[model samples]
Target: MEEKEPAPGGLALIEALVNTLDVESGTDALDTEENRTRFGLTPADTPGARELREALRATLLAHAGHHPATGPRPPELGRLLTAAPLTITIAPDGGATLAPSPTAPGAPALTARVAAAITEALLAGVWHRLKCCEAETCHWAYYDRSPASRGRWCSMSVCGARAKMRTYRARTRPA
Candidate 1:
Protein backbone atom coordinates (compact mmCIF):
# COMPACT_ATOMS: atom_id res chain seq x y z
CA MET A 1 0.00 0.00 0.00
CA GLU A 2 1.17 3.51 -0.79
CA GLU A 3 1.39 6.19 1.88
CA LYS A 4 -1.57 8.54 1.59
CA GLU A 5 -1.85 12.15 2.56
CA PRO A 6 -4.46 12.97 5.17
CA ALA A 7 -7.85 14.24 4.18
CA PRO A 8 -8.23 17.99 4.24
CA GLY A 9 -9.87 20.02 7.01
CA GLY A 10 -12.35 18.41 9.40
CA LEU A 11 -12.51 15.36 7.15
CA ALA A 12 -9.15 14.44 8.71
CA LEU A 13 -10.90 14.01 12.03
CA ILE A 14 -13.49 11.74 10.47
CA GLU A 15 -10.75 9.77 8.74
CA ALA A 16 -8.79 9.38 11.95
CA LEU A 17 -11.84 8.18 13.86
CA VAL A 18 -12.75 5.66 11.19
CA ASN A 19 -9.17 4.29 11.21
CA THR A 20 -8.98 3.87 15.00
CA LEU A 21 -9.70 0.22 14.61
CA ASP A 22 -7.31 -2.03 12.71
CA VAL A 23 -9.79 -4.61 11.45
CA GLU A 24 -7.24 -7.32 10.59
CA SER A 25 -5.42 -7.12 13.93
CA GLY A 26 -8.54 -6.37 15.96
CA THR A 27 -6.69 -3.55 17.67
CA ASP A 28 -8.75 -0.53 18.52
CA ALA A 29 -7.02 2.70 19.36
CA LEU A 30 -10.09 3.79 21.24
CA ASP A 31 -9.07 1.21 23.83
CA THR A 32 -6.14 3.45 24.74
CA GLU A 33 -6.39 6.43 27.07
CA GLU A 34 -4.41 8.74 24.76
CA ASN A 35 -6.56 7.98 21.73
CA ARG A 36 -9.75 8.31 23.78
CA THR A 37 -8.56 11.74 24.89
CA ARG A 38 -7.86 12.70 21.28
CA PHE A 39 -11.51 12.24 20.50
CA GLY A 40 -12.76 13.68 23.75
CA LEU A 41 -13.94 10.26 24.81
CA THR A 42 -13.88 8.73 28.27
CA PRO A 43 -13.81 5.06 29.23
CA ALA A 44 -17.58 5.13 29.40
CA ASP A 45 -17.65 6.60 25.90
CA THR A 46 -15.76 3.76 24.18
CA PRO A 47 -18.83 1.76 23.17
CA GLY A 48 -20.52 4.78 21.62
CA ALA A 49 -17.31 5.78 19.87
CA ARG A 50 -16.95 2.30 18.43
CA GLU A 51 -20.51 2.41 17.15
CA LEU A 52 -19.86 5.76 15.51
CA ARG A 53 -16.61 4.46 14.04
CA GLU A 54 -18.31 1.49 12.45
CA ALA A 55 -21.08 3.66 11.09
CA LEU A 56 -18.54 6.02 9.58
CA ARG A 57 -16.65 3.07 8.13
CA ALA A 58 -19.80 1.79 6.50
CA THR A 59 -20.42 5.18 4.97
CA LEU A 60 -16.87 5.40 3.67
CA LEU A 61 -17.18 1.93 2.23
CA ALA A 62 -20.30 2.96 0.39
CA HIS A 63 -18.36 5.83 -1.09
CA ALA A 64 -16.07 3.23 -2.65
CA GLY A 65 -19.00 1.13 -3.89
CA HIS A 66 -18.48 -1.52 -1.21
CA HIS A 67 -20.51 -2.92 1.69
CA PRO A 68 -19.47 -3.83 5.20
CA ALA A 69 -19.03 -7.61 5.54
CA THR A 70 -19.22 -8.11 9.32
CA GLY A 71 -20.67 -6.82 12.53
CA PRO A 72 -24.31 -5.96 13.14
CA ARG A 73 -25.35 -3.16 10.85
CA PRO A 74 -24.88 0.14 12.62
CA PRO A 75 -27.60 2.76 12.91
CA GLU A 76 -27.98 4.81 9.75
CA LEU A 77 -25.33 7.49 9.60
CA GLY A 78 -27.84 10.14 8.59
CA ARG A 79 -29.95 9.51 11.66
CA LEU A 80 -26.96 9.70 13.95
CA LEU A 81 -25.69 12.85 12.26
CA THR A 82 -29.06 14.53 12.35
CA ALA A 83 -29.21 14.00 16.09
CA ALA A 84 -25.95 15.86 16.63
CA PRO A 85 -26.32 19.10 18.58
CA LEU A 86 -24.86 21.58 16.12
CA THR A 87 -25.42 25.32 15.85
CA ILE A 88 -24.43 27.75 13.12
CA THR A 89 -22.11 30.57 14.00
CA ILE A 90 -21.50 33.50 11.68
CA ALA A 91 -18.08 35.08 11.54
CA PRO A 92 -17.34 38.77 11.03
CA ASP A 93 -16.49 37.99 7.41
CA GLY A 94 -20.08 36.71 6.90
CA GLY A 95 -19.01 33.11 6.77
CA ALA A 96 -21.19 30.73 8.72
CA THR A 97 -19.99 27.42 10.09
CA LEU A 98 -21.39 24.64 12.22
CA ALA A 99 -20.26 24.36 15.81
CA PRO A 100 -21.06 21.73 18.37
CA SER A 101 -23.39 22.93 21.11
CA PRO A 102 -21.50 23.83 24.26
CA THR A 103 -23.54 21.47 26.39
CA ALA A 104 -22.73 18.41 24.26
CA PRO A 105 -20.21 16.26 26.13
CA GLY A 106 -17.88 13.43 25.17
CA ALA A 107 -19.39 11.21 22.48
CA PRO A 108 -22.13 13.64 21.61
CA ALA A 109 -19.56 16.36 21.12
CA LEU A 110 -17.55 14.05 18.90
CA THR A 111 -20.69 13.30 16.90
CA ALA A 112 -21.35 16.97 16.47
CA ARG A 113 -17.81 17.47 15.26
CA VAL A 114 -18.23 14.68 12.74
CA ALA A 115 -21.50 16.15 11.52
CA ALA A 116 -19.86 19.50 11.04
CA ALA A 117 -16.96 17.89 9.16
CA ILE A 118 -19.33 16.08 6.83
CA THR A 119 -21.19 19.29 6.20
CA GLU A 120 -17.99 21.11 5.30
CA ALA A 121 -16.78 18.31 3.08
CA LEU A 122 -20.09 18.19 1.24
CA LEU A 123 -19.96 21.89 0.48
CA ALA A 124 -16.39 21.54 -0.71
CA GLY A 125 -17.48 18.76 -3.08
CA VAL A 126 -14.87 16.41 -1.65
CA TRP A 127 -16.99 14.17 0.55
CA HIS A 128 -17.09 11.44 -2.04
CA ARG A 129 -13.33 11.50 -2.41
CA LEU A 130 -12.94 10.09 1.06
CA LYS A 131 -13.34 6.34 0.75
CA CYS A 132 -12.50 3.06 2.46
CA CYS A 133 -10.21 0.54 0.82
CA GLU A 134 -12.03 -2.18 -1.10
CA ALA A 135 -9.91 -4.87 0.57
CA GLU A 136 -12.22 -6.50 3.11
CA THR A 137 -9.42 -7.28 5.54
CA CYS A 138 -8.12 -3.72 5.39
CA HIS A 139 -10.98 -1.38 4.97
CA TRP A 140 -8.79 1.55 5.87
CA ALA A 141 -10.10 5.05 5.12
CA TYR A 142 -8.18 7.11 2.58
CA TYR A 143 -8.63 10.26 0.55
CA ASP A 144 -9.01 9.37 -3.14
CA ARG A 145 -6.57 11.70 -4.85
CA SER A 146 -6.42 9.95 -8.17
CA PRO A 147 -7.25 12.11 -11.15
CA ALA A 148 -10.30 9.93 -11.81
CA SER A 149 -11.22 9.69 -8.12
CA ARG A 150 -11.60 5.92 -8.33
CA GLY A 151 -8.84 4.62 -6.11
CA ARG A 152 -9.80 1.16 -4.83
CA TRP A 153 -7.22 0.15 -2.25
CA CYS A 154 -5.48 2.18 0.45
CA SER A 155 -2.08 1.35 -1.05
CA MET A 156 -1.10 0.01 -4.45
CA SER A 157 2.06 -1.51 -2.95
CA VAL A 158 0.14 -3.61 -0.46
CA CYS A 159 -3.57 -4.43 -0.85
CA GLY A 160 -3.65 -3.83 -4.60
CA ALA A 161 -0.58 -5.99 -5.15
CA ARG A 162 -2.01 -8.75 -2.99
CA ALA A 163 -5.28 -8.77 -4.90
CA LYS A 164 -3.49 -8.85 -8.26
CA MET A 165 -1.29 -11.71 -7.09
CA ARG A 166 -4.34 -13.67 -6.00
CA THR A 167 -6.00 -13.22 -9.39
CA TYR A 168 -2.77 -14.25 -11.17
CA ARG A 169 -2.45 -17.44 -9.09
CA ALA A 170 -6.07 -18.36 -9.70
CA ARG A 171 -5.59 -17.91 -13.45
CA THR A 172 -2.42 -20.05 -13.56
CA ARG A 173 -3.47 -22.91 -11.20
CA PRO A 174 -5.05 -26.18 -12.38
CA ALA A 175 -8.79 -26.14 -12.57
Candidate 2:
Protein backbone atom coordinates (compact mmCIF):
# COMPACT_ATOMS: atom_id res chain seq x y z
CA MET A 1 0.00 0.00 0.00
CA GLU A 2 2.90 2.35 0.76
CA GLU A 3 4.42 1.72 -2.68
CA LYS A 4 6.44 -1.05 -1.02
CA GLU A 5 6.90 -4.58 -2.25
CA PRO A 6 3.70 -6.35 -3.04
CA ALA A 7 2.55 -8.67 -0.29
CA PRO A 8 2.61 -12.47 -0.69
CA GLY A 9 0.11 -14.55 -2.66
CA GLY A 10 -3.54 -15.49 -2.21
CA LEU A 11 -5.60 -12.88 -0.38
CA ALA A 12 -2.42 -10.84 -0.07
CA LEU A 13 -2.81 -9.50 -3.59
CA ILE A 14 -6.23 -8.13 -2.77
CA GLU A 15 -4.74 -6.53 0.34
CA ALA A 16 -1.91 -5.10 -1.67
CA LEU A 17 -4.37 -3.56 -4.11
CA VAL A 18 -6.65 -2.17 -1.43
CA ASN A 19 -3.78 -0.81 0.62
CA THR A 20 -2.72 1.19 -2.43
CA LEU A 21 -5.81 3.23 -1.69
CA ASP A 22 -5.39 5.71 1.16
CA VAL A 23 -8.35 5.30 3.50
CA GLU A 24 -8.67 8.83 4.92
CA SER A 25 -7.53 10.78 1.87
CA GLY A 26 -9.17 8.69 -0.82
CA THR A 27 -5.92 8.99 -2.76
CA ASP A 28 -5.14 6.01 -4.95
CA ALA A 29 -2.02 4.82 -6.66
CA LEU A 30 -4.03 3.34 -9.48
CA ASP A 31 -5.05 6.83 -10.59
CA THR A 32 -1.68 7.93 -11.83
CA GLU A 33 0.71 6.44 -14.36
CA GLU A 34 3.74 6.99 -12.12
CA ASN A 35 2.13 5.49 -9.03
CA ARG A 36 0.61 2.70 -11.04
CA THR A 37 4.02 1.67 -12.35
CA ARG A 38 5.43 1.81 -8.84
CA PHE A 39 2.71 -0.59 -7.77
CA GLY A 40 3.36 -2.81 -10.83
CA LEU A 41 0.19 -1.75 -12.57
CA THR A 42 0.30 -1.35 -16.31
CA PRO A 43 0.74 2.09 -17.82
CA ALA A 44 -2.80 1.88 -19.11
CA ASP A 45 -4.43 2.63 -15.78
CA THR A 46 -8.14 3.17 -16.34
CA PRO A 47 -10.50 5.85 -15.10
CA GLY A 48 -12.72 4.74 -12.24
CA ALA A 49 -10.22 1.98 -11.53
CA ARG A 50 -9.76 3.47 -8.11
CA GLU A 51 -13.51 3.41 -7.58
CA LEU A 52 -13.60 -0.27 -8.48
CA ARG A 53 -10.78 -0.99 -6.05
CA GLU A 54 -12.57 0.98 -3.36
CA ALA A 55 -15.72 -0.97 -4.04
CA LEU A 56 -13.85 -4.21 -3.65
CA ARG A 57 -12.17 -3.10 -0.43
CA ALA A 58 -15.42 -1.77 1.04
CA THR A 59 -17.16 -5.02 0.29
CA LEU A 60 -14.46 -7.00 2.10
CA LEU A 61 -14.41 -4.65 5.08
CA ALA A 62 -18.19 -4.83 5.30
CA HIS A 63 -17.84 -8.58 5.49
CA ALA A 64 -15.75 -8.11 8.66
CA GLY A 65 -18.41 -5.81 10.18
CA HIS A 66 -16.33 -2.68 9.64
CA HIS A 67 -17.73 0.40 7.93
CA PRO A 68 -15.43 2.95 6.41
CA ALA A 69 -15.09 6.13 8.43
CA THR A 70 -15.82 8.15 5.30
CA GLY A 71 -17.00 7.66 1.72
CA PRO A 72 -20.23 6.19 0.45
CA ARG A 73 -20.75 2.44 0.60
CA PRO A 74 -20.45 0.86 -2.81
CA PRO A 75 -23.69 -0.37 -4.32
CA GLU A 76 -24.30 -4.10 -4.68
CA LEU A 77 -23.00 -4.33 -8.22
CA GLY A 78 -22.37 -8.06 -7.93
CA ARG A 79 -19.30 -9.78 -9.36
CA LEU A 80 -16.93 -7.59 -11.41
CA LEU A 81 -18.72 -8.89 -14.50
CA THR A 82 -16.00 -8.48 -17.08
CA ALA A 83 -16.21 -9.24 -20.76
CA ALA A 84 -13.14 -11.43 -20.44
CA PRO A 85 -14.17 -14.28 -18.19
CA LEU A 86 -11.84 -16.74 -16.54
CA THR A 87 -11.42 -19.90 -18.52
CA ILE A 88 -12.24 -23.03 -16.56
CA THR A 89 -11.10 -26.39 -17.80
CA ILE A 90 -11.82 -29.68 -16.09
CA ALA A 91 -8.81 -31.91 -15.96
CA PRO A 92 -8.86 -35.48 -17.16
CA ASP A 93 -8.25 -36.70 -13.63
CA GLY A 94 -11.21 -34.75 -12.23
CA GLY A 95 -9.27 -31.58 -11.46
CA ALA A 96 -10.02 -28.10 -12.75
CA THR A 97 -7.96 -25.12 -13.84
CA LEU A 98 -9.01 -21.51 -14.22
CA ALA A 99 -7.25 -19.17 -16.61
CA PRO A 100 -8.06 -15.71 -17.95
CA SER A 101 -9.46 -15.42 -21.41
CA PRO A 102 -7.36 -13.20 -23.72
CA THR A 103 -10.11 -10.80 -24.65
CA ALA A 104 -9.89 -7.53 -22.74
CA PRO A 105 -6.52 -5.79 -22.66
CA GLY A 106 -4.85 -2.87 -20.87
CA ALA A 107 -6.57 -1.31 -17.87
CA PRO A 108 -9.78 -3.22 -18.31
CA ALA A 109 -7.63 -6.32 -18.44
CA LEU A 110 -5.91 -5.40 -15.19
CA THR A 111 -9.27 -4.91 -13.52
CA ALA A 112 -10.27 -8.35 -14.69
CA ARG A 113 -7.06 -9.78 -13.28
CA VAL A 114 -7.73 -8.29 -9.87
CA ALA A 115 -11.32 -9.42 -10.05
CA ALA A 116 -10.22 -12.94 -10.90
CA ALA A 117 -7.86 -13.07 -7.95
CA ILE A 118 -10.68 -11.96 -5.66
CA THR A 119 -13.03 -14.51 -7.18
CA GLU A 120 -10.51 -17.26 -6.56
CA ALA A 121 -10.07 -16.23 -2.95
CA LEU A 122 -13.83 -15.99 -2.48
CA LEU A 123 -14.30 -19.53 -3.78
CA ALA A 124 -11.67 -20.69 -1.29
CA GLY A 125 -13.75 -19.22 1.58
CA VAL A 126 -10.90 -17.01 2.82
CA TRP A 127 -12.00 -13.67 1.36
CA HIS A 128 -13.86 -12.65 4.52
CA ARG A 129 -10.76 -13.17 6.63
CA LEU A 130 -8.75 -10.39 5.00
CA LYS A 131 -9.19 -6.89 6.44
CA CYS A 132 -7.69 -3.42 6.62
CA CYS A 133 -6.25 -2.16 9.86
CA GLU A 134 -8.77 0.11 11.63
CA ALA A 135 -6.31 2.87 12.50
CA GLU A 136 -7.07 5.86 10.28
CA THR A 137 -3.43 6.58 9.47
CA CYS A 138 -2.23 3.00 9.59
CA HIS A 139 -4.60 1.05 7.42
CA TRP A 140 -2.31 -1.86 6.69
CA ALA A 141 -3.56 -4.89 4.89
CA TYR A 142 -3.49 -8.06 6.93
CA TYR A 143 -4.92 -11.55 7.02
CA ASP A 144 -7.07 -12.37 10.05
CA ARG A 145 -5.40 -15.49 11.38
CA SER A 146 -7.02 -15.22 14.79
CA PRO A 147 -8.66 -18.41 15.96
CA ALA A 148 -12.11 -16.87 16.28
CA SER A 149 -11.58 -14.65 13.21
CA ARG A 150 -12.67 -11.67 15.32
CA GLY A 151 -9.38 -9.80 15.05
CA ARG A 152 -9.84 -6.08 14.38
CA TRP A 153 -6.38 -4.61 14.73
CA CYS A 154 -3.48 -5.48 12.49
CA SER A 155 -1.30 -5.93 15.58
CA MET A 156 -2.36 -5.89 19.18
CA SER A 157 1.05 -4.60 20.29
CA VAL A 158 0.68 -1.56 18.07
CA CYS A 159 -2.70 -0.43 16.76
CA GLY A 160 -4.70 -2.35 19.35
CA ALA A 161 -2.66 -1.10 22.31
CA ARG A 162 -2.73 2.47 21.04
CA ALA A 163 -6.49 2.32 20.64
CA LYS A 164 -6.88 0.89 24.14
CA MET A 165 -4.66 3.59 25.61
CA ARG A 166 -6.64 6.30 23.88
CA THR A 167 -9.87 4.89 25.25
CA TYR A 168 -8.38 4.63 28.75
CA ARG A 169 -7.17 8.24 28.68
CA ALA A 170 -10.45 9.52 27.34
CA ARG A 171 -12.36 7.80 30.14
CA THR A 172 -9.99 8.85 32.96
CA ARG A 173 -8.94 12.39 32.04
CA PRO A 174 -10.32 15.28 34.14
CA ALA A 175 -13.21 17.09 32.54
Candidate 3:
Protein backbone atom coordinates (compact mmCIF):
# COMPACT_ATOMS: atom_id res chain seq x y z
CA MET A 1 0.00 0.00 0.00
CA GLU A 2 1.08 3.56 -0.48
CA GLU A 3 2.62 5.28 2.53
CA LYS A 4 0.34 7.74 4.26
CA GLU A 5 1.09 11.40 3.77
CA PRO A 6 3.25 12.87 6.50
CA ALA A 7 1.68 15.48 8.73
CA PRO A 8 2.58 18.99 7.56
CA GLY A 9 4.74 20.40 10.33
CA GLY A 10 4.92 23.72 8.54
CA LEU A 11 1.17 23.85 8.41
CA ALA A 12 1.15 22.68 12.02
CA LEU A 13 2.98 25.88 12.86
CA ILE A 14 0.06 27.90 11.56
CA GLU A 15 -2.62 25.74 13.16
CA ALA A 16 -0.89 25.73 16.51
CA LEU A 17 -0.68 29.49 16.36
CA VAL A 18 -4.39 29.80 15.80
CA ASN A 19 -5.28 27.11 18.30
CA THR A 20 -3.34 29.09 20.87
CA LEU A 21 -5.95 31.80 20.55
CA ASP A 22 -8.87 29.40 20.61
CA VAL A 23 -11.10 31.24 23.06
CA GLU A 24 -12.27 27.99 24.60
CA SER A 25 -9.67 25.27 24.24
CA GLY A 26 -6.44 27.08 23.48
CA THR A 27 -6.70 29.79 26.11
CA ASP A 28 -7.90 27.39 28.78
CA ALA A 29 -5.24 24.81 27.94
CA LEU A 30 -2.30 27.24 27.73
CA ASP A 31 -2.65 28.01 31.43
CA THR A 32 -0.93 24.70 32.19
CA GLU A 33 2.32 23.04 31.03
CA GLU A 34 0.97 19.57 30.20
CA ASN A 35 -1.97 20.87 28.22
CA ARG A 36 0.34 23.07 26.23
CA THR A 37 2.50 20.13 25.18
CA ARG A 38 -0.54 17.96 24.68
CA PHE A 39 -1.66 20.53 22.19
CA GLY A 40 1.73 20.08 20.44
CA LEU A 41 2.82 23.47 21.68
CA THR A 42 6.52 24.34 21.85
CA PRO A 43 6.58 26.25 25.13
CA ALA A 44 5.65 29.82 24.30
CA ASP A 45 6.80 30.85 27.77
CA THR A 46 10.43 30.32 26.73
CA PRO A 47 11.55 31.05 23.19
CA GLY A 48 9.70 29.05 20.60
CA ALA A 49 5.97 28.81 21.15
CA ARG A 50 5.60 31.64 23.63
CA GLU A 51 7.20 34.10 21.27
CA LEU A 52 4.75 33.21 18.50
CA ARG A 53 1.82 33.38 20.87
CA GLU A 54 2.85 36.81 22.08
CA ALA A 55 3.29 37.99 18.51
CA LEU A 56 -0.23 36.86 17.67
CA ARG A 57 -1.57 38.63 20.75
CA ALA A 58 0.08 41.85 19.66
CA THR A 59 -1.46 41.57 16.19
CA LEU A 60 -4.93 40.99 17.57
CA LEU A 61 -4.54 43.90 19.97
CA ALA A 62 -3.51 46.15 17.13
CA HIS A 63 -6.51 45.16 15.05
CA ALA A 64 -8.84 45.58 18.02
CA GLY A 65 -7.52 49.06 18.62
CA HIS A 66 -8.52 50.07 15.12
CA HIS A 67 -11.91 48.36 15.18
CA PRO A 68 -13.97 49.10 18.24
CA ALA A 69 -16.02 46.26 19.73
CA THR A 70 -19.00 46.10 17.39
CA GLY A 71 -19.62 42.89 19.20
CA PRO A 72 -17.35 40.69 21.25
CA ARG A 73 -14.62 38.89 19.30
CA PRO A 74 -16.19 35.66 18.16
CA PRO A 75 -14.39 33.52 20.69
CA GLU A 76 -11.35 33.20 18.44
CA LEU A 77 -13.13 33.49 15.09
CA GLY A 78 -14.55 29.97 15.35
CA ARG A 79 -12.10 27.82 13.35
CA LEU A 80 -10.47 27.98 9.93
CA LEU A 81 -8.68 25.21 8.08
CA THR A 82 -7.12 27.52 5.56
CA ALA A 83 -6.30 31.21 5.30
CA ALA A 84 -9.64 32.19 3.86
CA PRO A 85 -9.26 33.68 0.44
CA LEU A 86 -12.20 36.00 0.97
CA THR A 87 -11.42 39.68 1.20
CA ILE A 88 -12.94 40.66 4.51
CA THR A 89 -13.88 44.34 4.47
CA ILE A 90 -15.80 46.46 6.95
CA ALA A 91 -17.87 49.25 5.34
CA PRO A 92 -18.13 52.52 7.25
CA ASP A 93 -21.77 51.57 7.84
CA GLY A 94 -20.45 48.74 10.03
CA GLY A 95 -21.38 46.18 7.39
CA ALA A 96 -18.81 43.61 6.28
CA THR A 97 -18.19 42.14 2.83
CA LEU A 98 -16.35 39.05 1.63
CA ALA A 99 -14.65 39.60 -1.67
CA PRO A 100 -11.50 38.08 -3.07
CA SER A 101 -8.52 38.65 -0.80
CA PRO A 102 -6.08 41.15 -2.24
CA THR A 103 -2.74 39.97 -3.53
CA ALA A 104 0.32 41.23 -1.70
CA PRO A 105 2.19 43.88 -3.66
CA GLY A 106 5.68 42.87 -4.84
CA ALA A 107 6.22 39.64 -2.92
CA PRO A 108 3.38 40.01 -0.43
CA ALA A 109 2.46 42.17 2.51
CA LEU A 110 3.74 40.50 5.65
CA THR A 111 1.21 42.15 7.86
CA ALA A 112 1.41 40.83 11.41
CA ARG A 113 -2.35 40.38 11.68
CA VAL A 114 -2.54 38.48 8.38
CA ALA A 115 0.37 36.33 9.45
CA ALA A 116 -1.37 35.51 12.71
CA ALA A 117 -4.58 34.67 10.88
CA ILE A 118 -2.78 32.22 8.64
CA THR A 119 -1.06 30.54 11.54
CA GLU A 120 -4.26 30.28 13.52
CA ALA A 121 -6.12 28.76 10.61
CA LEU A 122 -3.52 26.03 10.44
CA LEU A 123 -4.12 25.09 14.08
CA ALA A 124 -7.80 25.81 14.05
CA GLY A 125 -7.96 22.03 13.98
CA VAL A 126 -10.18 22.63 11.01
CA TRP A 127 -8.07 20.26 8.93
CA HIS A 128 -5.68 18.77 11.48
CA ARG A 129 -5.44 17.32 14.96
CA LEU A 130 -4.94 19.55 17.94
CA LYS A 131 -3.52 16.75 20.15
CA CYS A 132 -0.29 14.82 19.59
CA CYS A 133 1.41 11.57 20.56
CA GLU A 134 2.50 10.51 24.04
CA ALA A 135 5.44 8.54 22.57
CA GLU A 136 8.73 9.95 21.38
CA THR A 137 10.71 9.40 18.13
CA CYS A 138 7.61 9.26 15.99
CA HIS A 139 6.36 12.29 14.12
CA TRP A 140 3.11 10.48 13.42
CA ALA A 141 0.93 13.24 14.77
CA TYR A 142 -2.57 14.35 13.82
CA TYR A 143 -5.70 13.23 15.59
CA ASP A 144 -9.16 14.18 14.46
CA ARG A 145 -11.42 13.94 17.51
CA SER A 146 -14.60 13.49 15.61
CA PRO A 147 -17.91 12.75 17.26
CA ALA A 148 -16.75 9.17 17.79
CA SER A 149 -13.48 10.25 19.37
CA ARG A 150 -12.18 7.02 17.84
CA GLY A 151 -8.83 8.52 16.92
CA ARG A 152 -6.14 6.68 18.90
CA TRP A 153 -2.85 7.38 17.11
CA CYS A 154 -1.20 9.66 14.65
CA SER A 155 -0.81 6.62 12.42
CA MET A 156 -1.76 3.13 13.41
CA SER A 157 1.08 1.51 11.44
CA VAL A 158 3.62 3.81 13.00
CA CYS A 159 2.80 5.09 16.47
CA GLY A 160 -0.41 3.36 17.39
CA ALA A 161 0.57 -0.15 16.39
CA ARG A 162 4.00 0.21 17.93
CA ALA A 163 2.44 1.28 21.17
CA LYS A 164 0.05 -1.63 21.08
CA MET A 165 2.81 -4.14 20.34
CA ARG A 166 4.94 -2.80 23.13
CA THR A 167 2.09 -3.14 25.56
CA TYR A 168 1.33 -6.67 24.35
CA ARG A 169 4.92 -7.79 24.75
CA ALA A 170 5.10 -6.33 28.20
CA ARG A 171 1.95 -8.18 29.29
CA THR A 172 3.05 -11.48 27.70
CA ARG A 173 6.60 -11.38 29.11
CA PRO A 174 7.43 -13.34 32.26
CA ALA A 175 7.13 -11.20 35.34
lDDT per residue for candidate 2 within 30-140, as digits (tens), equals 767776764445654545456566666667666667776665666442545454356777999998766666775555555666667767777887777777777776666
Largest TM-score belongs to which candidate? 1
* Model 2 residue 115 lDDT score: 63
- Compute each candidate's TM-score over C-alphas: 0.94, 0.76, 0.36
Report lDDT (Cα) of residue 167, candidate 2. 99
Where model 3 places Cα greater than 4 Å from the true spot, the runs are 1-88, 91-128, 143-147
Displacement of residue 170 (Cα, Å) in model 2 is 2.0
What count of clashes does model 2 give? 0
Q: Compute the lDDT for candidate 2.
A: 0.66
Alpha-carbon lDDT, every model: 0.91, 0.66, 0.42
Q: Quick one: best lDDT, which candidate?
A: 1
Residues 18-126, candidate 3: write the lDDT tens digits.
Answer: 3444332334446677756554443443343444444443333332232223453432332221333446678999976444346632111222233444554455544
Better of 1 and 3 by lDDT: 1
Candidate 2 vs. true structure, TM-score: 0.76
Clashing residue pairs in candidate 2 are: none
